[model samples]
Target chain A: MQVELQLFATLRKYAPDQPLDKGLVMNVEPPLTVSILLEKAGVPLDKVKIIMVNNRHAGFDQELAAGDRVAAFPPVAGG
Target chain B: MTERYARQLNLPHWTPETQQHLAAARVLVVGAGGLGSAVLPYLVAAGIGLTGIVEDDRVDLTNLQRQVLYDTQDIGVPKAEAASRRLAALNPDVEIRSHRTRLEPGNAAAILAGYDLVVDCTDNSAARELLNRTCLNLEKPWIHAAVSEYFGQVTTLLPGGPCWQCLSGTGAPADPPPAGILGPVAGLIGSVQATEALKQLTGTGRLLVERLLVWDALLPGWAEFSYRRNPDCWACGRG
Candidate 1:
């Protein structure tokens, strides 16, 4: 299965080669979860604030399907 | 100057009735900092009836980069006072109230009660949490915006939508206040807050309800995720 990985804010530095907003395409095995996906992208788990697959609030352990657009955001609390 | 809102009124759906709703609306802006600087002027200039400002800190030289409502000589002055003075000049027809204090548990209810809606431009976790819970109890709608570096997020929290707790399981990012902000990033997010405020008052556009709109200047695009009312939300949840 192939999934699109999007890393936002400071997390973007991890996937520097990925195009902006378009995300990176990664070939992954089945039964992949959000946590494992982030680990595969080299995005630190501690820095993750919100995780979503195809724009819905999601959990780290949630199972992923092919073509899932996964996004991770850091806490963005500044004005 | 005869037609102050001639431009906005010319928009396809804008009408005199919408302008009237805007004229009668009362809005409270918490934190007269970067985002506040961007939001207050628009609200005042757009002719909102009453605009209240809650900002306790005095302006520092450092804030001038993004807090455009203040100037060099105005650095020592209170942000609420400085911003109010500037906003008043921008449009003297509107009422601008300045509350030169932080919004806390002791004062949040009383302050928020007077306004129809609140705008969260505060940078700290405490102000965000206080505004979130207080608005819930007071039954008011609010627009939330936050920024750091090249990234920012904006959302509208209505009476029945997901409360802050549901979206922000943690009150804020675990890190401390981000010291660096690209001035335009703050301005961009605040502009969305101001636009949301106008829509909420006039019922003119599809409000950003139940959506967290995120933008990163580096990626230079917007991505939003829809969320629902968390039945287990600590504030508005059924559980």
Candidate 2:
């Protein structure tokens, strides 16, 4: 299945594993959950505070579908 | 609709009624730091009748990097007091009140009780958590914005909508971890937050009710994502 992964804020620097910033469309094996997908995309789960599967709040264990948009971002905690 | 708001009133969908709404609205900004510095000026200049500031920290030299409401001489003064003075000078038509206290559990509700709306410029999750529960119980609308490094995000939280805890997915509140941030990053996010507050107050345009708008300076673009209210969430939900 092909999915678009978005790494926001400092999460954009992930490379050598995801190898792209902002939006990246790639093909991954089926049966992917948000947590496993983050691992495969080289985005550390610790850095992510909000997860949106196709723009809605989703859990890490939520299943992914074809053409799913997975956006993960860190908590931007500065004033 | 006098000469002060002539330019904004000329804007599309803005009129005498919108000006009246702005003039009659009472907004509370919790945190006199970067975001508050920006939000206060815009809202005051545009004419929010009563603008209350809830801040207990004194100004520091290090804060001058982005807290435009303070100056070199304001380093040792309390943030809310200094901000009130500066804002009063900017527009005498607006009322500026300084709470001079932090947003703790005992005082959050009382401070918020006097205002019709709130703008969250606070830097910690614990403050946001308290605000979410309080505003939800009070049925008031609020705008939430935060910044770090080269990015920030903003959203408008209305009564019966998805709240901070729904987005956080955590029942417990934590302190905001320190992070490096550029002055402009905070300024940009605060600017957006100010816009949201004004828009929401006057009932003018589409708001970020269910949407979280992200600004990435490195990418130099705006991306929006949505989140629905969680039925089992602690703050707004029956849980």
Candidate 3:
């Protein structure tokens, strides 16, 4: 299964040499959880404060299906 | 309506009645930094009856880049006071109150209780979360905007609707890397917040409620994504 991973703000640093918005495509086995994907992508779980799956908020334990679009954002603390 | 608002009144949506509605509305803007600098002037110029600015930080030399409400002369002065003075001079018809204090859970409710609406212009997540809980508890509608470098996001959280917690959850992350924000990005998001406030107050046009509008200057475009109320959301959940 392949999933698209998008990152925003500081989390963009975790993207694998690709356009952050365009996202990176990663292949993983079935029964992938958000936490597992973040670990595989080397994005520290603590670094991601917001997770959007298919543009909807999802929890760390949420299961990911094939071809899911996941967006992760770190907390932005400036005005 | 006075001759001052004549230009806005000429617009198709804004009539003398909408001007009157603006004059009767009260709003609280929670931060006197980048976004507030842009949000305050527009809200005052549009004639919100009473505008409360809550900020505790004193202006620093570093703030002039985007906190347009202050100047080099304002460096060392409290931001709330500096902003109040400047905004008042822009429009004396609109009343401006400066609450020069940091907003926390203990004081958030009292500071926010009377306003008809709130604009969450705070830079940090803790303040944003506090405003969300307080507004939810008060049943007041508030607009939330955040800017990081060239990216910005804006959303409106009405009572019983999707909220900040529903989007980001309740936990605050440990201090992440410092954010890099461009001046115009703040201005853009702040202007959008002011526009949302006016529409919310006058009961005109579509509100951004339940929708998060994300703008990326690099992409030079906007992508709006809809979010639903989380049944387990700590702020506005059924449980």
Candidate 4:
């Protein structure tokens, strides 16, 4: 399945050649959970502020079907 | 009646009844910095009856990167006062109130008493928690937005939805890494906050509700996460 992935802040370094700072995007196996996808991408899930599936909110265990757009935000410490 | 809101009156499904509801709504926004700077003008211009701004910090040159409400001449002045002045000028028909004090548990309830809704634009977790606790008790809806560098997140909390603590939990995470935002990024999140406020105020469309809207302007895309009220949340549990 193709699940769109977005990485925030320093995590953008994972995909350096990309035009922008968003993290890498990859095609993962079927039934992707947010935690598993992040783990597969080598993103530290603990650093995430929250994850959004499509335009609605989803928890870590929420399943990602085909064509799910996933964007992850790291904790924002900046004022 | 729609003529009063003739400009936005053409915007989508919003109607005169919604405009009337907005004219009768009251909202309180904490911290007049980046998020508040972007949130205030739009809410006032949209004709929210009474909008209150509370902040104790004064403008510093460093804030110019994102705090759009203040100009060079306004530096050294209090944030709430400067913001109130500009917001008032932006829309004289809407009432603007300024409270130049830090938000603490003691005065939180009193300050939040009359407003129909609140916006949490404060930077720190401690203050954010306080606002959450206060609103949770009062059952007031609030929009929460936080930014660090290039990324930011937003969510809307109705009376029973998941709250800030439900997501962050009791023990605060260690200070996040050094993250600063591009000016437009803050503007974008703040604008979303403003739009959410308008939605809640006018009852026109579905709100962000239990979902978290996170965005990275660098990638310039949005991700949403669904959250439920934690059965054991100290602030908004099944009490």
Highest DockQ among the candidates is held by which one? Answer: 3
lDDT head-to-head 3 vs 4, winner: 3
lDDT of 1 by residue, A24-75 (tens): 9999998899989989999878778778789998778889999999988877
The models' CA-based lDDT, in order, is 0.87, 0.86, 0.86, 0.80
Q: Write the per-residue lDDT of candidate 3 for residues B114-191, one digit (tens) a residue.
A: 799999899888888788889888999999998898888899989978888888772457755567788998999999
TM-score of chain A of 4: 0.81
Candidate 2 C-alpha lDDT tens digits along A1-79: 9998888766777843443344688789999998888898787777778888888878889999999998888777788
Error of 2 at A25 (Å): 4.4
Candidate 2: clashing residue pairs, number: 0
Interface C-alpha RMSD after superposing true interface residues, each candidate, one decimal? 2.4, 2.6, 2.1, 3.6
TM-score, per-candidate, Cα-based:
0.94, 0.93, 0.93, 0.82
- Cα error, candidate 3, residue B48 (Å): 0.9
Query: DockQ (Cα-based) per candidate?
Result: 0.56, 0.55, 0.57, 0.33
Q: Candidate 3 docking category?
A: medium
| Among all candidates shown, the one with the greatest lDDT | 1
Clashing pairs in 2: none
Q: How many steric clashes between backbone atoms does each model show?
A: 1, 0, 1, 11
CA deviation > 4 Å runs, candidate 3 = B170-172
